[model samples]
Target: MRIELVQLENIRSHVKSTVPFTRGFNCLVGGLGCGKSSVLYAIDFALFGDPLGRSYNYLLREDAETGKVTVQFSQNGKSYTISRGLKRRGKGISQDFDQLKLLEGEKLVASVKSEAVAEQLKAITGLDKDVFREIVWVRQERLKELLDAKPRERQKRLDELFGLSDYEKAWSNLAGYQREYEGEKRAYEKDPDVIGMEKLNMEYNQTAEEFSRLEIELQGIAKKLEEARKTLEEADLKLKELEEIRNLTEELKRKEAQLQVNLTNIEDASAGLAGKIEEKKNLIENFKQRLSTAENRLNPTRLGSRK
Candidate 1:
């Protein structure tokens, strides 16, 4: 929707001027006396039901003058017209002090009923003020206000702009899951490997069995190693004793060889001496035999003297 012309009668400084507008980037530039911004306010009134949520006549050209505004615009490729008239008597009283007329194409489909007719006019125009503000309503002053806003106010504005409500819901769900995970962690942190309370007693039985097996194996190995070490020490002692016996046996064999040689030499010399003695005895026996023979011959001589 786009507005082309806005006629303000006794509305602010517009007086009776039909302020022309453009479809895009429209600027109403003039000196301070000219109603440049007042023209913008006139368009604002036609769409906003009331310009500033107050009486439309408050922005009229003069206090005593009757206030009326007419806006011509294009909606959905069709030309439309909306008109509002304001009364000055009731300043803040609730009464039918305003009127609205809407014309669609070449027909007046929206009829005027109650005088305070901004709502009825909107129903005919199908124009949402919020949508209009988004596209066309802006000011440098408003930009400054937003930029200079407080941190909390800016946060609210940013939330409204980016629609962060869904993130809040997701965070709540994540928090719920985190709480559940923490609960599960706490439950099983120190839990035994046993399956159930009834089966838990089997843990002690199995552990005791394993402990007995390990103890038996360890004792066997210890005994084997101790026996091996003791055998090694005993073998070392026996080897030393055998070495001493071998040395003594070798010495005794050498002494026996020397004693046997001495005994053989003594036997040879003594046998020679004994043989010489026997020969001397034989010679004495031969001399005795010769002397006996001579005596026998001499006995015959005594008888043979006279021969």
Candidate 2:
């Protein structure tokens, strides 16, 4: 993994710093206590988070309440950024897990999870903390010691760095594992199950036949269930139709009752109108009789007076 940039905020002697690195062999050349090593520490913290022999208090600036480190790097032609933070807690400083993040380009890969970031970084860079410290980021003082060391010691360290030791250890452990496996194999060979292999196969076949028969029965039951479901659906539809007819019948009954009431009211109104007509006819007949009497009396008076 190639580091492209390292950013620091309130880290050690630097209050704020942004150091950009190029593609190949970039070195930090500064006087003593010039915050050059602080940048390296920040990069490491950003990658692996508070490694062994380092603490949040060491990375965080003295008297500073908070600190942050952001590292941008590229591996296998894919860019990634790792950000981590530290905060003072009471008398001690601790990682601000809320600020832990790993991003690929603008896409977030991990957030607020140190373990997730470490795993992703391991996968991307193919370097764990040990390999990074031993091989990738060798200290200036440790460089002389590594160079002046014996060939055997140097080779051993390099083997550990390259993970050859793990393979060697696995090879060494395989002898014991093989012995255990052989013992278990012998025990398994003498077991009743292994001895009755042919009988077990026959039983398995019988069980398989029984399962097939059951499956056929289940299919038949499923067919019946489907037919029953269809019949139930038809019954429900018929029930709905009957309910609609019942509602219509009740509505017709209500209308018939209202029509009967209206017919009674019309009959009562017709009887009252007939009674008024009869009274008017009687009054007319009485007025005609009075008028006829008055005419007859006037005619007689006229005749007598004239005679």
For this target, which candidate reaches the highest TM-score against the unseen true structure? 2
Question: Global lDDT of each model?
Answer: 0.71, 0.89
lDDT of 2 by residue, 1-307 (tens): 7888888999999999999999778888989998998988888888888744866778889989999999999988999988999999999899999989899999999888788888888888888998788778888777888999999998888886786888888998998999999999999888998879968889999999999999999999999999999999999999999999999999999999999999999999989999998998888888899999999989999999999
Provide the TM-score for each candidate, comma-separated.
0.45, 0.52
RMSD of 2: 10.2
Worst 10 residues of 2 by lDDT: 50-59
In model 1, the runs with Cα more than 4 Å from the true position are 53-57, 90-98, 111-127, 131-135, 150-152, 158-307
* Candidate 1, 164-283: lDDT as tens digits: 777998999999999999998777755665246436668778888999999999999999999999999999999999999999999999999998898888888788877887787787
Candidate 2, number of clashes: 0
What lDDT is obtained when candidate 2 is compared to the true structure?
0.89
